[model samples]
Target chain A: MRSKIVLVLLLVLYGCSFFLRGEDPKLDLGDNVMEGVFFQGGYGMQWVHDTAAEFERAHPEITAYVWGNPRAWDQTRPRFLSGNPPDVFWGIHNINFWVNLHDGLVANLDSLMEAPAYGQEGVKFRDTFFDGTLEEGQFEGHQYFLPITYAISGIWYNKGMFDEHGWTEPETWDEFLALCETIKQTGGGVAPLTHQGKYPSYFGMIWRGLVYKLGGEQLMCDMDSLVPGAWSRPEILEACRLSRQLYERDYVLPGTSSFSHTEAQMIWIQGKAAMIPCGTWLASEMKNALPEDFDMRLMSVPGFRDGKGGIGAMEASAGPAFWIPVEAANPLAGMEYLRILLSRKMAANFLSTVGSVQPIKGSTEGVNVPPATQSALDRIAAAGGETFAFQFSGWYLELENEYRNALGALLNDDITPERFAARMEAMAERLRQDPDTIRFSRSPRGDGVAAL
Target chain B: MSLQNNGRVALLFVLPAFLFYLTFLIVPYALAFGVSFVKWRGVTLNMEYTGLGNFAKMIGDPFFWKSLYNTVFFTVLTGIIVPCMALYFAVAVTRKLVAGARFFRITFFFPNLISQVAIAVLWWFALNPEFGILSNFLRLFGFTDLPSWLGEPGWARAAIVAVKVWAAVGFYMVLYVSAIEGIPEDYYDACKIDGAGEWQSFRHVTLPLLSEMMKVTGVFLLLNGFGTFDVVRIMTDGGPDRATETLATYIYENAFELGKFGYATTIAMTLFLITFSLAMLSLWIQRRDSVEY
Candidate 1:
């Protein structure tokens, strides 16, 4: 009798295990069920959980199983090569992920953009966004992904400081330099401008702004096409010279090399610096870091003598995009979720919550945009400002690093402006020589042949 | 029959742990070696076998050389400074030369208990050139300007070493203290009876017996130095121009930041071989005959 009871209990336990391992009863989608379209959390996917819930409510046939940050591509790529990948991935850095698009790992969204449901919304979508946001997502005239947010790099200043000093905003290069001199003479002690010299991206912003101011939008655009010997040109030389002069005058903060972007911003907030070149995200971040009443203003980098000082180039770069992997268990459902995310309602919600500039058309109503940001938007619209050009997508990381190092050297007076220009030229020459090291098939004309 | 059954059960108990080691350790290491030969851009769906291309590339890579130099400099500095200071403190505590020995022990060991990330952040704040506590204190002494601790290349490397030593010396001090306590009191008593001074007793008797403990500490320090990453990354991110980069941080940046998986794995494999050989050599050299109790 004891042996029989043990046998019965063992059989029941084994039966329960099988029953528990069977399909989830909650998701009863019959034969049309789609799985694995939901992701819980990541750099840019915090909203996906809620978005997926809404998506599921609208489409009951689709079942989504959310996962973690798509196990960084270093780990995930091997799985992709082995024929398994996530249905959708979020938080992909724009420049690096462009390679995935070039390699055909992600679906081409051009056809989807043309479909009636997607096209009508997409055509209006293209027209509604700031001009350069979409360009960052495109390569060789085809779009692989849609930008969820657009980050524009510009100069942010403390209005209260400027006002307290009885100084007017400078409108030209001469005026800007004169303002720096005035600040110095008055013993402001604070730097006129603060930036992260250690980060190549921050220097890239200054370089792009200089290109725009000196040569105008067309010349800046030409530089990106690999115009041979472009850096050796007079305009580029003057920009380097001006940057060196600024450093010599101590116009920038001390120990800039040690500070990160956030640290530099903190200095500005604490009134240690008069100005900072940062992105639109700074407005929200500043609010969070300090009292809500702290006053700040955003404007373009001051321009040169020949150019309008307020007429600066703003960097409207690609932010983050979501991609549906080719090996996904349910590709269409993933794409549908993306579509919902790109919808006007979702765009407004994201903008309100995260202060991200949505790519969708029309202003986000009921979103409490900071007054300083609104003032910046107004300035840009009034000035007819041009968007800055990025030379190579993310593949230019090496080139950028070299340029930043040269700039840092120049800032420390370790290198001459002429030498800096020569180094910049050499970087272009190196890129031209080593096609494999800096490969971008989409832009074959980008072989140091274009001019700024 | 009963003894055989007991042996079988013991083997069964050990099987799970053995399987875990084989899966997690042995497999990943073998896979890392295999991946080192490929040219993979991490995110791409394709990989090409590059043979010895990556290893060859390391020869000319300035960043790799810079990182190696920094790692060696950091290791050498910490290896000498930490153990000496630890030994000094251990002697002081063991000899009862200082009052409140327990307080001193706890104070020295306190830093070791703090997470490296927290310590790095604390140092960063303290060293901030404009408003940091150290900077402010320096200014009060009429030194108006000082190089940023983690910004200038030379200073950055020095700061990294200093921070490592500060966080590490205490733990090693405790180790030395424990080892010194284990020495029989009779040796010291005999030395005193023989008219030997404290310093002479330490030099003649204490030093020789502590060789085993020194070897253990040295090996630990060497291995830890080779793998230094967190403090550098959090404090400097190998910056002010890659002046403070270590092998581990370099590998991470190449793999995650630059998307060069094959290149990063190649670096990791090189580091593994170098560190493994050095560790083995140290262990072999330190394998002295066990001293009689």
Candidate 2:
């Protein structure tokens, strides 16, 4: 039949179409060549390009190529699947570090960490980083990620406003509450505290700080490890109650829950609010929007008077982690590039250009940074052995989402602290029970930090 | 030419398009269906055959139920409201009941020309609680405490539906206009001679005459409502406690964000089936007695 002939012809043509499609052209990567793919986010790509150029200049025999965009991962993911990933990459939040590590796609950076520092005399590369910075990137006693930037989350306020009002930073929870009351009464329609309510994760740092203040770093580890009934602990409930008091007492900016992160920050910047909670990146992210007279400064979240982690305890973490693919063509060159990137000169350049701290110690020495960044550095220094960061949020995204939702509801006055705690515990229990969920156990390091 | 030769020629002409459809649509859909049966993390080739495990998970997941509920609510609400309002506007403009009918027709169809994402962003800014046009206008009327339109759970769902109707009513109005104009004028003349008023004429003659087009518009609106993604994605991002989370957004979150590729594919398969079944039901209902005037 004619129909049978047509069907046979179509099947043959479909088979021909497959044969007509040629194989993907292989890229010609020469000897000692390192390709870098970076995400061009708020910090931008100038620093990355400069670091690449420095690496090339140091090792003229090697060619270092760099390319990036805001959606660099969109292009890089396919390469990863094809086993032709870039030698080094940074600012990729799309790739799951745990999944990549489990699949052996991420390279262990132990050898790089044990190597000598790029320029520091007789210093191991690992010792060049600040304390508690590199710990987040390690797994099973081997480093798998290299955190390029260091950040500390705290309350940001205009130094000029504080000085004008003769308001000193609070050191204890009671003093913090008293200061909020004073600001509400005397500050002429200014709300005492505002947070990036659109992103409830911003408020998590405050609550985590409170948790550390109440029960020390071990409580945070227990919660992160999903220790049985950890969410029902008194310390977490108290932290939730204290955070909710800001909303219940109307000390928070009106309609803050509706504003985006930038919008909320602008509200604090425009002097409508006395203080805002944010990370050190606040300075750079809002650089162009800031008024000339704005003297942004940071302060660790105030602690309880009888707390375990002390008043000076703070939440600090290395951010925007960088990594080398396990199957990179020039893994050694990629390590070299990272080492050069963490050198004092480049770290200082990162500080000056990006208005954020690098994980490298002494990078801020003699470098003129924005007062807000300097304040973050000072806080990190003051915390000393007390700096702590929670691993649960980053480890379990479902838990993070539930926490954010509950926190948003609590801030919006739709739920009580008990209800919020119950919601979080339920989510934590689900994640702990779910065999498919990749749960990581964390133990408290001897020094007040949780090692994931 | 012989009838058999003519059929052969027609088959040859359809070959290119049929091949394209098979390659792009059929192949990918089949592949996705196969993937829905396995447990894969989306990044690598490591897959475990989980059989009905994903389906069991979907049945138990509260978020999946919430998204399905939202999707159904969105589809039904938009499906009913859009066509009714669009028909009203079309009749008004076509019958010259409203002044400046030509200008109104253009204005109604204006939103259809804008991309859905652009419209979402524009509405987002317009509905912002602080410094937004709506809030500022409300403030002028002594409404000191305006509700957060995009931030509250209840208001956010309502706002998304309202915006969807606003952006969609225009396109449907254009379709109805064409359908109305296509109806013969003799029927209206006959209705007028039979002592029928405007309402009676519309109820008897025009309504029956437009039934076929009504079926078409209903099906279109149903499809558009079921495929609601861009506007809600840009506006609420399924936020304010997963209030406006559509199946599409949840699919994206599961596949891309949470890396549950198999789970997301299962959700997509269910969505496709629901949309197809609803469309078929619509056709079945209308196929019984379609007016062909």
Candidate 3:
């Protein structure tokens, strides 16, 4: 009897391990069920849940099981490996979209894009979104990914503080520098500028804006395409020099480099710093911590006097990519879910809930947007479709990291502007030379060489 | 019952745990070993065989060398500093030389009870340059040119080491305290009966008997040092231009951030070899030098 009891206990333990490896029950719920996973980031998952519910309500034939967490990709990655991926997913930064496209993991969404809009009477699904917003998701003229939101990167400042201090928004690089100096002298102890230093890539937006200002949009395109010696251009070095001066002149907040994104933003919101560089999502992300009557506003990066791209060129693009796996159980359902999610009604709901804009055309119509996002929309309207986005950084991790690290080093005064340019050029050269490294090419917007 | 029946019972008891170990640990490691020789982008669907290529690439990569140097630096410094400080405190508290010995013991061990990520965040805040406790305290005097501890490369490494030591020394100190308490008091009494002074008695009796525990703690700390991921990941994120990039962080960056599974696993294999060899070498040295009491 004792031996039998011991054997039973061993068998029980083994059974428990097997139970631990059991598949998620939702997987066996049949074809009508569609699984959708998302990254619960700055924009909370309320929108995802609402969209899912709406999707299921609209298409009564399908059941949408959508879930998200801050780090949901950790769980989703294994599911992909096991050939049991969600029908639709978003925010797996590890999977390079281009590489996935090459490996036949991402479904080609060309037919979905060409399909008629879900709610609109006669508009194609592709036409429902704002112009130039859907271009980034295209690989070899086929859509493989779609963006959930749109954002414009710029310099954010407290309008209340600016008005009190008699500070006017600058339109040129020289005026911006003079304003910085004036702020340094008169704005009490507040620094002229601050940035998300721990995440050094925040500085890249400002740098890219400067690049576009000094050089033309074509120059930006050439650099993105990995054209030889493009990174070593004089315009690139000048942008490096101008950005470095922010640190050298002590215009940046002291010890800003040690701060996490939120810590730096908190300082900016506390009136410790006069301005900060961030995307339109900044105000929404910090809504809980913001003080009363902060009056946050964003301004485009000031252009140079001799710049080619003009001050109106705003670097606006879609954000937080979405994709459907090729092996999804319910591909049609997933596409339908996307159409519902991107409908103009849901887009307005997203703005009210998340305080950000979606790429859906006229999504901001009649929506009471927060002050900061309104500023971004105003900046975008003023640009009149003169916008550009860099695809190289998203495509190449090695080059992106090198550029970010080099930018950090340069800002810290650890390296010269020339050396910074050299490092970037060398990395670009290496990438261009490596046959195994997948490369993407594009021409300037409206250049007729690529489909804008 | 026969002796064979006892053996059968023991085998039955061990089988469940052994199967779990084989399935989770051994099989995964074997798979990783095979993957280290292939070129994979980590989507789990596509792989190309590249035998010895990943190894050669790792050998030639400057970033790998830098990470290795950083890892070794952290491990050696932590190993030396943590043990010495722990042993000293353990001796003091065990001997009751300090007042409020119980209070002191608990205070030292408190940090160990807290999570490592929490400790790192607390330290990161404390060392913040603008409004951090350390910076404000320094500024209370005339010192205004405070260095950015987490921003500058050299200072960031120093700061990481200090935080790791602070969080680690407590647990090791508790370990030493127990080991010292377990030493037979009769030996010390015998030393007192002789003309041996306190220092001499401790050197001859305490040091010799503690060697076994020392070896055990040494191996434990060595393993801990090698797997130093959480604190660094939370604190500096191997930043200030990768100045604090340890092998662990670099492996994570490669595999997850860059999707270079083959190269990451190759580095992992190398790290395992290095860790295993060093651990064995330390054990051999300890066994040879350990005094039989």
Candidate 4:
């Protein structure tokens, strides 16, 4: 009887070892278990499918499957909430990263960044991006988002049209306005500038760059910290006033307000307008419709004459970020997969295939990046190859909404620049008084300098 | 069978329907009402009760008031025109004035068959300033400065109202048509014999008999306009700086977009009360003061 009891006890103890607390979930290296979901917006779905195929081939033991949809975030919300999230996902545009991190839902990726780039000896993953490129993804002094692409926001114009009209891209606010006036007077049917007015948030690129141009880092810091009247500061107000000048002078493309991003983009690409303020993605997003000789190029917003910041200040950020949920079936595997996903070769594939400039340094050196992307890259190089972004309302949806609403009002001429500033101040004050709201801590000059 | 036994049998018959109603309707509504008093994000179990905190916030919120005003404006516009337009069509179709009355009925009711989202999209394209039918007509007639219908403040509000009215007239018209058909043939014969004209017959004979449906439809149109979201979301998204934001859209923005479930529920509760009270009072007035043939 004693011998039988001992045997059973030993068997039970061995069984417990496989099912114990705090053990890492066994890596699903077998052919059936790995999968990834991505938000397939502007970038087509086929690229993700091909990438997954490549990943599977590289890891013969695992059969990785990937799928994406424009509404991926909404479709995957239930899974995330049920603690059955996708192995790897890209969800920043639609999901609240700050709140998710606060709730301990997203995995802390600091350690993952420390891992050297896969298949690249002694080259850490953290060093691949330009300095400050990953700062936008930082929360609470820790990184939670791993950016895949570098998105540059600026004025997109037709190089051919500019040359034909003998119009030089302006380097100052006054010169920019004068160019707009010239376009309005002589462009025949074309307007000076068209905007994606249907989406008010697209105004961020011009506004953020111009804000830094006029107020420098201190103003950005003031805005980020929610200082009283931060929005009403002289330079911020000047930017608003200058932006409104385009609207008030009837230089905006007629019917531009009714246009979606694609519609407005079509107008710009067709040379029906002089310029459209947009991101570097414009050429890739509208490639199918663009005329072959459109000669699309991007220019940073002209520096305000009396501005305090660098003249070459550009609004650039690490974007279309990928993240792993803490509840993921295999987070380690997921992070490893991200390394391969963002590898230099894959970044090159992305540049050639999608015309997107990845945050990975040297990824596009030998690749045939589209001319529009090259123009943006050259301009960033001109800015000393740095990335800078403000995290004011960008970090908080509520404040962002209020800012956009007030900005919309200003653009629509429903309110003066002072009123817009006062409205923003009042709105921020109200939010600051709320104890339950989620607020992000940020520095005046952003969390880190842009990587170089 | 005894009368009490019959009553018991009737109650037994109603039990299944009552259970369904309790489960689907009352339960969820009760949950919403309970949530209105809490500060929950709705994604997790972390909910805190803040009795009347959300309501108090609503009272001080300018967006709420603006949205409420927008909804009321939409409801009033639809309430006034939808019935008039629907009644005219219903009368014409039933009276057999058109050459193909059956065709007209189907044609008039065609829009209701499409989903509201599809309808919104259809109108979105149809109202495009460049290729839209309206814009083409406007430009053809020398209106070169085509207004941005869905982009300007007042124009966006007008666009939403116009779309809602156009899409809704068919449903209400069908309701009026059914009600008109139900009125006895004898009444019309009597009117014709008395040498009553078409207008007089419609005013005296047709109108009185259709009052019940008219009341239900009027209140329905009013409530639906107040609760509008799908069309507005697809068309304008309450834009040009929220000149067209309705209460329903604002509630969604707070709940799903901004993650303020508690405050969203509070606003929802307020909207429910306004619509419920209006529906009940209107019914009470209708019961107390409606005319009879």
Estimate the TM-score of every prediction.
Answer: 0.85, 0.94, 0.94, 0.91
Off by over 4 Å in 3: A1-31, A446-452, B1-18, B186-204
Q: Determine which window of 10 residues in candidate 1 chain A has minimal summed lDDT.
A: A443-452
| Backbone-clash count (model 4) | 6
How do these models rank on lDDT, best leading? 3, 2, 4, 1
Q: After superposition, how far is residue A327 of candidate 3 from its true place, in Å?
A: 0.9
Please provide, for model 3 over A76-190, each residue's C-alpha lDDT reduced to its tens digit, 9 standing for 90 to 100: 7777777878889886555566767777788989999999887788899999987777888988777888998788888999899999999998988889999999999999999
Deviation from truth (RMSD, Å), model 4: 8.8
> What value does the lDDT take at residue B112 in candidate 4?
90
Q: Residue A237 in candidate 1 has what lDDT?
A: 78
List the global CA lDDT of all models.
Answer: 0.72, 0.84, 0.86, 0.81
lDDT of 1 by residue, B104-179 (tens): 9999999988999999999988877767788799888998768777767778888899899999989999999999
Q: What value does the lDDT take at residue A221 in candidate 4?
A: 72
Model 4 C-alpha lDDT per residue in residues A1-452, reported as the tens digit of each score: 99999999999999988887463232434535566888877777666766677777777766676777777777787787677887888854446666766667788889988999866789998888766677777775688888867888889888988888898888787888899899988888778888887776676577777888888877777787777788789887888988888888988887777777887888777777889888877877887897777798888888866777767767777742688888888787688778887878788888888998888878998999888898898888887754466666446677788887778778777889899888888888887898876665555544324321
For model 2 chain A, the run of ten residues with the poorest summed lDDT: A23-32
What is the per-candidate TM-score for chain B?
0.94, 0.96, 0.95, 0.94
Measured with C-alpha atoms, the lDDT of residue A102 in candidate 2 is 76
**Candidate 2 vs candidate 3, lDDT winner:** 3
Q: Model 3: which residue pairs collide?
A: none
